[model samples]
Target: MSKEQGRTWDTSLFKRVFSFTKPYGGLLAIILTIITVLAILGPLRIALIDHMVHHFIEAKDLAGLRTFALIIVGILLGETFLNFATTYLSQKLGQSIVKDLRNQLFSHITKLRLKFFDKNPIGMLVTRAVSDMETVAQIFSQGFLSIIGDILVLVFALTMMFVINWQLAFIVLIPIPLLIIATNIFKKAIKKSFQDVRKEVSALNTFVQERITGMALVKVFGRSKREAKTFSEINNRHKKANIRSIWAYSIFFPVVEILSGLSLGLLILYTLSRVDDPGVNFGELAGQLTAFIMFINMIYRPIRMLADKFNTLQMGLVGAERVFKILDTDELIPNTGKVIKHDFKGGLSFKNVWFAYNNEDYVLKNLNFEVEAGETVAFVGATGAGKTSIINLLGRFYEFQKGSIEIDGEDIRDIELNLLRDNISVVLQDVFLYSGSIYDNVTLGNPEISKEQVVEAAKLVGAHEFIDRLPDGYDFNVKERGGLLSVGQRQLIAFIRAYVYQPKILILDEATSSIDSESEMLIQNAIDKLTKGRTSIVIAHRLSTIKNANKIIVLEKGEIIEMGSHAELLQQEDGAYRKLYETQFDGHEV
Candidate 1:
């Protein structure tokens, strides 16, 4: 059982769920009115039957019987129409609220910082946005309003039974207290079961999603049997959770049926005792007994369903609480800067910078660097030497703990987040392409970028030759993550995408590290054209790639030990850059 199952009906959460209905107030009022009328019609039909039996059927008046039967039939038709309207309108209201809530949830997630995604799993989020939202919809369509209609029916039925014959009504209600106690027990048990079911469902989704995405790795490592066994275990847990709810239902429903039967038996025994009364008319008494039986059935029908509806309401409230927790998160990157510059100069400087993924265990310690506008600066370091961390800090994907990063002498924090990112583009080693046509991927659904502009950018970056070789040229569809394309081909597409944006600053992080010699040559030529006039930052494992850079900075343990041109740095016999170059090209340790 979840912690939330211990609490009573959360009135504030209930109010929050209903608040989404404010936009459809008129429709809700109409649904309520229909439900009330439907409630009245149920008992009214029973009264009509009792009256016809006493006035027409008992007297053997056939003509009056025919007329009264038609009247009841007409009321039945109207009641049916009202039932249909209430069902249709309530579902419409529920779906509308779900749509709005999902939109808000998705929008809020998009604005959250990257750190949030790093900490949360994508499959858990997918369950919250999709399945949980559907559960919340049931609070309107199947849970709350249906329970209200059922209660109103009970109220009218009870009032009519007492008005016709008070003594019989009292006898029929003798077993109701026991039924109420049973219902309360059922509600608590079922609610705990539902909470378990929801938790298991989230776990199931997360496990399946991760395994499917990593299927290739599992097969390559020959762990298929192991993964299959793990999946079966998760599947069994989900099955067990649902079985718990089924167990509660199996016991509770039978108990309701038994109590309802006991109430009918009590009513019949009491009526038999009053049959020989001197003042009572047999016909009138028989009609009253019949009407009371109908009333008992009507009352017990809703009572039997009340436990199930209450469980649905509880589950929806649980789902809402989970979704609201995410919506309430305060981890969004602040975008309060008012500065917007159309022609941004890409001179960058970092002074006394310190950063870490967590706490003060810094990855880059007191780092300092400067890049003049339109200068190409290269950074060479081993893995985990704070290379990618610099790109993340510059884009404000993560925050730095100390010191300042400035662009064109203005602090990056003072610049609008979107505007600052718009002026820079980074092409990483692992390129991600959405499932769409090449044209769509290149433009990324932006209306401002024309097909001609995309074509021009492709030609400039030498990507047009391969793209033109495809059957559909720019119209070719690239499946998920560009799985159909080779590594070099995908890199070429990334270069074209970056070039089309015409960013003032360009970042290439291991862009040429994984490809054939021919593809690397093509990308190298494309890189020369791309960085000709833009401020560029290059991170490379290969020492030959950055020989022409204006300045080469060698970093070891997050601090720069050497900075100069390639020849100048090589001239120093003990320099880090000289040693790294010799290890790669001369095939020896220095």
Candidate 2:
């Protein structure tokens, strides 16, 4: 893929992330309050140590010293308990925020129109749902919480140090501006590096998934060596990006360490010069020294944390952008229509419909067709002759640009999408079986159905016989995408799925194309029973399968050039249907 065609996570990411917190405003507020308390305790500990050195040590009072030691121990224990509590609360809040994000993202993506999926691969979408959602979860789960604590601590430490001794604070802070500038510069470079790393990662993910899916083809073609080389090239790019990121951090962390160390050395030199002139007390010197060292240690950590988070944040932001990109896709066909809640009484008509994938060119143009209640109409055409497109339109997968589709007497545009789809069942050319028991896959179409109903549906589709042949029968576990089953068996299961729905309208888009002769015959009989009292639109390649269809429409290019019963079209001289029949049946008995 070209760089121009692919995209990284977008830049305007913070606003999107912060928006997720809106729904969980209450939990976030409590988390913030705990964070603020944690921050204030930063300077409080330093100040306590300073006071112990100056007052207790100078007074040479063992009793006072003992009391101070006890106070220090108590503060340590309190902070320990507070740390655990705050951590628990932050985790709970983070998980809540991520759950809300995942829910919104899931709902939004599922509602996106088909054209979105047409262009985006299933692998990329899987990345968004799994990897991207996990990334966002981590950002909220740990990164944001840590950042909050760091920011607050930095703020309190800076303020208290300045108040304690103005001159020393000014001298110590000289390195602060330089450190900030260095970190900001490092941040941009590292963010870009990590962004490159993430892009390469997604590319690798896409590449591996695509190859695994095409493994059979690759093995047959003997192209494993070439494919491995290609994979290695991509993997190496990812490696380089990771190495560069590590190098950037290596330079950045040690630089922070040195700058912070230098600040301490300068502060000590300045304090020593003052002590001789003012005849400073030993205990007072020790007190100031302890406070200064603690403040310097505090400064370096938050700086490093602030810098490091950008690495995680940028990667997560890019992931989030991809997820949101899918969510933000426009609906190609909006449902401004009324909900089709009541069962459809079948009558479906397409009035002079002109449809196109890109909307500019025609796949089906000015086409007019209608199926009466309980009619079984077959669309038989050569590949890419707009046969499947007809089924797509019937299922409301795509809307016509130049004409209207009506169901029963009402325009389909006026029907709520779910309500319209509720009474329609589509069996596509591709039979996707999930990794689960036979019963799980069959009943997936309508889980509320009874066990007996599932078995009945399976028997009707001729799936039960082979299902029973399996080790666990209906409970047989299918591997990934039902790879464990033969293609024909999978198709039979898909048939059972469609039949179980008992939809008002049935769409069979080459549904029987993958199965064997025996299974196909069984599927044909099942279809005959299933479509007994329903409207069925079938697009089939096997001319024999549609021989019994009540009406047959043959398309050439984007228009229907011929139409009649199987017998009527057969009798026409060199009719389009006759040519199709001759091609398929001439080679093999139809």
Candidate 3:
């Protein structure tokens, strides 16, 4: 179900898959060599049966018969051991390749631009990262090396059969061409069916993951029945897609079985017809016929399994196409700059910046502003006035269409993205806390920051009191998104996190909007300490909170209509900031 382009069964795709396996070349070489050996040894057991009949059974040599029985047992043991090794090694190799691939997918996705995530669903990405990867692994575990063994066995079986008795070999292989043709047709049909199955699987996973995540919302909206119906529809489509693959397999295997039976019948008929011929030895007839049956199975078994193997290959290729599409995507923000030093003094400027999520509809149009080092600038605006967008641009989370942003006199594009982001800290209105201990959440797994440092930062942000009151103190686990914590508590934790980082440029995007008056006062005190000597950008909805800011930039339609100190902006009779201040902080002296 995604409109993502798929790869055809092409050599290029195989090359990409094989590149991952190249590191395990020694192991693969051993597997392939053992497979070739197995192919050669496969016919030897049939030859042993022939030898037993001609040299031991008919000749009435009990000693020779005992020896032949022991040799057969020995061959079976050897084959079993080798077979186990091949399977074990193949699976191990596939798992290793998948591990590397999954890591790469995760890393690449993390590096991709925010727009890619905006366009793609998280559930669909989960399918690609997890389920699709398993299918890709199956290409090696069940399809690649096994196919090689099957093909080699077929080749060796045919060669040995022809060498033993050309006439019988020809008769036994009479239906092979038809089997090959049928398999080819089946390959094409099954490939398309497999693609359909994979698509449905992705759709099903996407539906389930999204529904589960939004289960609470569904219940609140009283649309549980509607969602269930939608889920059932998706589930049924997945089932139907699987059944389509099953149907192809069902039609194909029986046809292969019939062809195999026909080959055996032809061999028997041809051998029986040759009984009166002078060149035919009646003594070896039984032995030769037994060997011919083994040869037929060896050749036809691979032919039968080719359809299944081809199906596996197709599923993997489709999965690979989806994965490679992400890997190959050029939508990543190019990190061409090498500057790693982030000791910024925090003078920032946006020079005639134009931005749009989609190119046609501009959100921020020709916006220009400047903030001096250690200045706290508060942006006041209506909801869509591009306030939060400014923080996003400053952090380089998304790319702007036109113009440039400079930090500490260096163009943002020239400054390394990580370095630029490292010097800037953003505390959004909605704080996201990972599932970890309070200490870990504050430090964010940074080994450089000690527990003492975490405690000190929490105290500085006024988070230490509540954190210390908890059973585990700083070690208290903040469960999913800090669900156990109150909104004020989470905001305090976020303040602690930002404080611990000690970024040169601090951004509070309505950071205290959800806090109660008590918590807001504490946060306001923390903000004073936090923004003492840093470039701080504040986007606030509560006009009273930003009255003492060094500068207030009031935005409307992506451009500044008023820019001055809180008192100076209030003096303008028709200013937007004055109207906003009057409406929100009315009768309260600045």
Candidate 4:
């Protein structure tokens, strides 16, 4: 949920993560088989060492020594082959799981309601979808199978040591409990540090993404120094988190080396004292001693690295917790009924609507309105008068409480969401263009809209005049967010995009607010052609823009204060519309 929450790995979490590997059952089985064989070879390798020393070297058996050396080489080669296979399969498994998760996250996010995006930062979501999922991938690559193989090797090595010489084996294991205590302490500390690392990474990502998106503002206001200072603080936190993890590693590994040496010392001391005993053949015991030393390395190496691997496992679990939390969030706009098709007559009504973004803090209160088919209606109001909220409600971008919205005398809730939205199109003031060619942006990559239709729609919006001047004409690339295009040019593209949809209802939300007067005049005729014989709702701050509307509704604090034709509203004695026209339009002809 948050950085403050527990990040410890639990059995249930492991089970959940392991479930993702089920699709690769055949590959996972092969990996497990390789680990089992490698584990079984652990004791056999030590036994071979004993044979080569006592029977071949000490007894001077030349042919036997040659044979034993060959067997050792063969074993080494076979182990190498199995290790390669294991590494290859582990990587494949990790990548496959990450691919599935990325697709699912992208699909889920695309379908989520706009309200969800309002609450979560884009940088945080990107971190979860990209970086956090990579941590999950590590659970397969370095965390799960590798740990299992190390443990199996340790288990087999210990079994062989006891079988060879129980007394010496018991002496060699004296430091085990101490090693365990140290490892557990290291694990707890590193888990917290790793969690801190991930938290700092996410915070740093959010800060950088926001600052970069607003670089123009920073430069305009001369706030570069202040912004850089803030970024430095976040980057420093990230560095400290990494250093804390390094401190944990610095303390843990050397302690493991010390305990390993202690074990070796005790084994050597016991073997030397038993050297002269008649029951103990000195040569054979020395070989067993050599094998026992190798066993110590084989055993403790895994034990020591297990703390680090367990830290990876813990970080992965925390990432999963964040990822699944978003996947489990119930923020989707429910699609209940399915209506395949509707011939909407462009009628719309909002009956006694009361709404709020936050609980009970209404932005739209008791709003009642209706529009007949094929009428051009304009909503005029000051900022924060809930003008855009009405458009958002009609498009079903949000749900309202204690009211019903209808289309063509049918409750909009009864209509399928896609079908309802398909019949209405909105052109916002801030037009957003995707990174693509002009034709792609106009048709929005819809296969059903032909190239000829896209050109026709652009001609209607008068966008083709400027578009034809570009080097590639219709194929000219509008790079990221259409940065290469002017605001007026981008708005013209929006008009074409909306026109290509051919909707029954068209909404222009301050659509020409940012455009130059010449561009606005060019688009005015296109707007006249696009809205003819269709229900059009226009929201504008400029009084001159909506003067020709069939009806104008004046709003104040979410209530309809005046409704009439433009001339009728202006004729009222000291009316709100007349006052707004005087204050906003001044000398501009209307």
Task: Give per-residue lDDT, candidate 4, residue 152.
Answer: 93
Determine which window of 10 residues in candidate 2 has minimal summed lDDT: 1-10
Report clash pairs, candidate 1. none
- How high is each candidate's TM-score? 0.95, 0.93, 0.94, 0.95
Per-residue lDDT over 185-262 for candidate 3, one digit per residue giving the tens place of the 0 to 100 score: 888777777777777878888888787867779999999899989989988888887788788889999999999999
In candidate 2, stretches whose alpha carbon ends up further than 4 angstroms from where it belongs are 1-13, 138-145, 587-590
Model with the higher TM-score, candidate 2 or 4: 4
**Each prediction's whole-model lDDT (CA):** 0.89, 0.81, 0.86, 0.87
Candidate 2 residue-wise lDDT at 263 = 92
Task: Tell me the tens digit of each residue's lDDT in model 2 across 251-369.
Answer: 98898998998899999999888777666787877887889888999978888878777556655666677777777777646877666566679888889999998957999988888
Q: Residue 522 in model 1: shift from native, Å?
A: 2.2
In model 2, pairs of residues that clash are 9-318, 337-414, 338-414, 338-416
Per-model root-mean-square deviation over C-alphas: 2.2, 2.9, 2.4, 2.2
lDDT of 1 at 328: 93
The alpha-carbon deviation from the true structure for residue 580 of candidate 2, after best TM-score superposition, in angstroms, is 2.3
- For model 1, how does the per-residue alpha-carbon lDDT over 1-590 read when each residue is reduced to its tens digit? 34696786899988998999999999999999999999999999988888888788888889999988998999899999999998999899889998999999999998888889999998899999988998899898889999999999999999998898888889999999999999999898888888888888898889888888787799999999999899899889889889989999999889888988898899889889888989978778778878888888899999989989988987888888888889999888788876876568789999999988888888898888899999999999889888888988898988889999999988888899999988899989998899888888887888999999999999988899889999899999998888889999899889988988889899999999999899998999989999999999999998778889998888877777788898899999988888889889894432
* Prediction 1 TM-score vs. true: 0.95
Following a full C-alpha superposition, what root-mean-square deviation does model 4 have from the true structure? Answer: 2.2
- Put down candidate 4 lDDT per residue, 1-590, tens digits, no spaces: 44434535477767877888888899889889999998887678778988798778888899999999899888888888888888888888888988887788888888788889899998899899989999988888888888898899988988898888788789988999999999999998888788888988999889888888788899999999999999999999899989998998999999999999999999999888888788977678878998999988888999999988877877787787788888888787777746668889899888999989889989888888888999999999889999999988888788888798888888887888888888999998988888999899988879999988888988887888899999899899989889999988998888888898999999999988888889889778778888999999999987788888998999998888999998999899789998888777683655
Which regions of candidate 3 deviate over 4 angstroms?
A: 1-8, 272-280
Model 4 residue 130 CA deviation in Å: 1.1
The number of clashing residue pairs in each candidate reads 0, 4, 0, 0
Model 2 lDDT at residue 219:
100
Q: Tell me, by lDDT, which candidate is best.
A: 1
